[model samples]
Target: MAYKAHKLLEGYEKANSDNLPEVNIIALAHFIAKDSNFISPEISNIKAMRNGRESYGESAIGYVQLKREGHITTVISCVAPEHKVTSNGYKVEIVVDSSKGEITSCKCYSCIAALGGCKHQLALLGWMHRRFEDKTPTEKACYWKKSKLSNVGKTIKFILVKDLGSKSKEKRKNMCKKKNKLSSEIIQKRKPKRKIYKVKSKINVRKDPDGVSFLQEVIAHMDCKLKKGNVKVIPELAKIFLPVDKFDSIDIHSLMKDELCDEVAKSTSNQTDNPLWRRLRYLRITASNLYAVAHCNTVNGSLVDILHGAKLRETSAMARGTRLESQVLQIVSKKQKMIFERCGLLTCPEHPIFGASPDGINENFTVEIKCPTNYKSYFNFIDSSGKIKPQCKAQVQLQMHLSGRKKSLFCVASPEFENNRKVKILPVDYDENYIRAVMVKAEQFWKNTIGKFVLE
Candidate 1:
């Protein structure tokens, strides 16, 4: 039974390209693997080709083999020079269909970016192209020899340019070192010369005045300006420069509250296009990101950078949610028979740096709406069994806390469902423990990571 199965598998295996004529193999390799920027002029592709050419010229390619099945051919090779200690380098494979006149796939087993095509595969391809370019139609040069790298620490102490191979005896003869009198003269002339200069050190004899003297001078100047009725000198400027008896005596909480209120008033519209809204949200750790901030494990990861005003490009799902939010809210309001009033950002009084901008708020509860882009997400929301996603739960809890409400309605909407089943409303009660834990993490993150960017 094992022999029969082996025979069947052998019948299905692709034929080795070694059986094909040398001319045909060379033609196929050249057609698929020739280096040119005409097909793809991207910088990344050009860079890969440049590195691959260097690898090919360095004789890094080893143990190349080809397999053919109908019109498709696959070239496989080992690239051995990339690693200093390991003899078995990355396995690179390139698949090409001559009938299509294009490479179907290229992969490097040891490369992280193998899915996107890597340099090792390109090195094998360039090696094939060099073989085709170097050999004539009538000459059948064998490509089965081991790579130069395979002889490292054995048979050869080191590899040199002269050892790679010489096409002509004259070229080999001219490879010997020759003396250049002109180069030696140029090097001698370019040598650096030492120079010495006299230096003297000086010290100031005068003593600097203290802070009180500078403050008295500033106060006297300001008083003189005020007495002259100089309208250019504003009273607010005097207040800023004036020295106070104690810094702790200032009402920082009231000042922060007033500043936050002013910002909220400026960004009351809360629309995405509003510049003030974007700017205000850009500075604060908004409720939507609370879950990520709470759960992040690294101090300087991408999440911290994002919170520090790094702009994230909008995805299709975000665009869809933004476009369908108003319609979903209308549907929920109509179905629930309650008016949901749209409100601007609500900042926490105690933690002024944290804020939440809920979808809508009423006398009893705040509302947060979600529009899932697909049926799977829609169904997941509908069949959640009184459990909410951690991120969504965190957002709603923060919204409820900021709005001073005890309950929030988590609504999910999808237009693809039937009209009767288009919206799913789940009532989420405010959880004090969860919100407290989240706030602790958020505070630590803000102090350790985001405070420098925001406060400075």
Candidate 2:
């Protein structure tokens, strides 16, 4: 159990991300009313950002251009409601913008922030799209894209994190009932038998099958139901079957920023040809910059001010009451074990990992007794704002990628140092480019700078 916390972090990440509903604001607003003019062009952009249109950069504001019609849904529930779904509903407000008089940008704060898609959004959509009746596919959608909800409609908020149907309820009840079946909370060992039966086999097929042989058989037995040819695989794999991304590869000139090359240009003070420190610094800086751009808000042609009330000082308060900021985080994390669903609903996917399990897992997504110092340091570096101190998602991404999971939940121990911690379900999209970049920087530091003398 010494390493129990590690598994807990993984579990926390997995459990938080599980089956929460995602409803598009544009679609939801339209469904509410069309004549309502709250849906903004920026909100529409967010809906189209994830499509096939490739835009590459540290942030979405500069590089991405969304052309297709943006679709946003008010809110949808994974859990099927009994007579009525009470929790899954919201009033999605939108602001439409036209620069040079073209429809663009949509800001959907209420729709995404509060998981709601009740009749409010639908009615709003209806009002916007008055061309049709209060109900219809096209009318509902158009209304959402152009409408604004009434002041009364803006007050609803709901929580629909999972698909809890009648069947699920019964299953949950059965699980609860099974908990009582344990007569005693004790580990019981089986009594030893006097002598084990020994049978001598004449056949010599007992050669121990090593991993390679087992793996060969595993590969041979696997099949894809949809494959018309033996070589066919999922369509997604086929698209990116090309070589690794050139942006972070041997073609360093194309992928890396000029700042990295500038490091190599520096005069070497170390006698050894390799230095790890400089390389690590470069890796950290590049990754952190990208992460910062991703997390900083950009809803209304404005980036959110992260340091609004943050106080910066080298001084550490020695008073017991003030010295307990970190302690509160630990306590809050411990108390939040019961109501993880609430955390999942509030958590943002853009956030970084928290309370990590050190060197536990490799790239495949795992954990162990201990990990390399670099990995542990990465987790410890998180700041009080519930943001990772390194300001990068690389390490967490590596953890999730290694675990073979596409998403995980990250909880920030409350900044207010409260007893209850807030959790966010972060979606980790593994980028081999990032992993390779970090390694390359590590290697360069060891080979060409003062870092060669230090472990770094």
Candidate 3:
């Protein structure tokens, strides 16, 4: 079964490039298995393992394989990052081959199937429809199902778009015979015996503040703007000394990678037109990104590599991408102060003892931003009936508790583009008094969730 894109996206990678995007398959599998909600979670835990590749590399790239009228069709995709305006975030590549009309082989990127597309698939699909679909009679008719039978079901489905003849009838009968034989053999294969392995009880590890002080230090460094990208990652030596390979271990993350991401975005694409504006934007990003990084980094639970890296100016681009990034960020901070004053947003007596930043204030109403690293397919801010979206409400409620505001709003930033940028808002309507009660519960939960960990 070949992967066929709606469009054949071949040779489309001249568009955008990023860093090393290929990920280990086992890591991808383990991530899908571990995450209870299949969503990525930010954590403060640190562990390291020593392992190397023990298997084959990925096979399919650029296109996803899907069921067509009957046979497998590969749908190629072209991705013109959020920066590419020629596309509406996603561009497709569809091509139909001569020998195999609906068949497509993707030569573009890897794993655009389950994740997302890049430029390669876009070119493929475009060439297929525009060039071939018109000139050939066989191209106009998809006899794909007429040639294959019963991959998903026992019955052979015949779709009609053209008149059939003796030649067509013979082809259908022969294909159905091949399908039935294949189906019977498939059915004869015995199901593997299910194993009944005894599950071990989960041990609650005590959280050790002394042991985790390294993590707190790391976060403190992040506050100073450190630790980002693959260059010069801080190592956690404790994991090196400790042996955690007794039980099978796996990392959990759906890695979205692009080897040419930096190249495409930086070299081929448009640079921000204004340097001053870029500086101002970087400043806002640095602050908010640092704040989020700080909160996710709990005390006594982070790593030493991150700790000192955050403090170092030279090693961590995140800590200090350029002196320019820092200067612009400072300007943005001043700009933010001006915006708050102009918009009549609230200014607290001082910054919160906790990590929350106040986003907006009109009269007594306050809104907070909880920037998610990724955005889901649809923005479910409010349902069809106009009720508050549960996810947005929960995020806003967390900010409210931290800000001590009765009511709070949650604003989401677009994840498709640059970091530290956002759009759209969802405000949680709740009384300060009522939310306070909820806040107490939440705070207690945070402290207690790791309460057992403190003992470890």
TM-score of each model, in listed order: 0.46, 0.20, 0.29
**How does model 2 score by TM-score?**
0.20
- Candidate 3 per-residue lDDT, tens place, 12-77, comes to 222111111111233233432453322223232111010111110010112222223323333333
In candidate 2, stretches whose alpha carbon ends up further than 4 angstroms from where it belongs are 1-390, 400-407, 454-456
Write one digit per residue (lDDT tens) for candidate 2, span 1-456: 222211222212211111111223443334233423333323463422321111110101110111112332122112111123333323223222211111122332234422333323332222222311222233222111211111112343432333311125787789877675433222221334335222112111211122121111111112222223543222222122222343322221122233332232232222123232222222121222334434434422211111111112221112322344235334433543321111000111111111112222222232111111122222444444646434446555544533344543333322233333332323245666765455444333323321211111
Task: Rank by lDDT, highest first.
Answer: 1, 3, 2
lDDT of each: 0.59, 0.27, 0.31
Model 1 TM-score is 0.46
Give lDDT for model 1: 0.59
Q: Tell how far residue 424 is off in model 3, in angstroms.
A: 5.6
Comparing 1 and 3 on lDDT, the stronger one = 1
lDDT of 1 by residue, 1-456 (tens): 221211223223322222321223444345434544322446455656565564443477755566778777776666765446235566677676654445666667866756555666667666655553443335444444556766766776776655553235665455432235446646755877335221111101111122122112222222344335543332332222223243433332332344545357335645566544554554367888898888887887888756645666554457778877777888889988989887676764466557787888888888888877555456444565657788888899998887779999999876453354487788999898989899888867766664433221
lDDT (Cα) of model 2: 0.27
Q: Relative to the unseen true structure, what is the C-alpha lDDT of residue 357 in candidate 1, on a scale of 0 to 100?
A: 78
